[model samples]
Target: MMRVLLAVLFVSAGVMHFVIEPTFTAMVPPFLPAPRVLVWISGVAEIALGLATLAPRLRPYAGWGLVALLIAVFPANVYMVFDDTPAIDAPRWALWARLPIQALLVGWAIWATEATKLVRR
Candidate 1:
């Protein structure tokens, strides 16, 4: 199911935060203080929200949380693309691709959890 798939994607990404800490830490925008702490906190949030999506009662909140998380991290994606020295070794095009991909992920969370339906009630 799409919900399960989304959960897996997020959970995997959350785990990767710790597995490749440096890459994520580097992705933090310069204006932010304590990049390492922020990375760890976001990782925990991702894992929690990802698992929350599995519970029917929690799915809507999880979906909204994902949307917020995606938006919160948007600046980092931009930083990676525009920073004087690239954060990672990724190609410029690939970095650019991530911007739109964030929108897709937001849409996916909405569709997978039917969060909009909850709003209608």
Candidate 2:
């Protein structure tokens, strides 16, 4: 089901955060302090949210937390697009496309967790 997929996605991403720490660290905008700290914290949050989403009673909170997490990490996505860092090596279109993809992910989390509906603007 959607819930299971979300859990896997988050868990895998969380693990990758550690496995490929430098790649993620490069995405952090220069304005942000302590890239290593942010990367580790984000990874931990992803793992926690992924596990929490599995619990029916905690699904709502986990979903909202994911939404916040996605929003919080968005600047890194932006930084990637502009910097076009060779570290990730993603195609230009794919890099730009990640913006809307984040919204879609937020919607997916809401649907999977049965949280409040996301109204399209």
Candidate 3:
């Protein structure tokens, strides 16, 4: 059931990437080239990866992929923290607060798909 919820969360988040394009665009760090391109690419990848997590055989790989995804996109999360006006209008502390939450997200992805079991064996 946790896996199901995480999969659904990814799918919804992936779709929201497009639905909230401007906001996503705003999150991109200025140093990166083609922010729009990266936004779309990440969205599509999220959808594919999210669906892959639904299959019993694919869950482990997809779970690790999500772990990577979270790490890869973390810089933007950091950037959003310092931005004078983050698109979501989150309070300053909330922006800073989200950083540690990423670790929890990584842990949840691992547990939901039982990725740790793969590593332990």
TM-scores for all candidates?
Answer: 0.95, 0.93, 0.92
* Best candidate (score: TM-score): 1
How much does candidate 2 score in TM-score? 0.93
Instruction: For each candidate in the order shown, give its overall lDDT on alpha carbons.
Output: 0.92, 0.91, 0.88
Query: What does candidate 2's lDDT look like per residue over 1-121, in tens digits?
Result: 8899999999899989999999999999999999999999999999999989999888888999999999999999999889967788889899899999999999999889877733331
- lDDT at 14, model 3: 91
The 10 consecutive residues of candidate 2 with the worst lDDT sum are: 112-121
In model 3, which runs have C-alpha deviations exceeding 4 angstroms? none
Q: Which pairs in model 3 have colliding backbones?
A: none
What's the ranking of the predictions by TM-score, best on top? Answer: 1, 2, 3
| Order of models, best lDDT first | 1, 2, 3
Poorest 10 consecutive residues of model 1 by lDDT?
82-91
Residue 113, candidate 1: Cα error in Å is: 1.0
Instruction: Give the lDDT of residue 34 in candidate 3.
Output: 92
User: lDDT tens digits, residues 7-49, model 3?
Assistant: 9988888998899988988988899999989999889878888
Candidate 3, residue 61: CA error in Å? 0.3
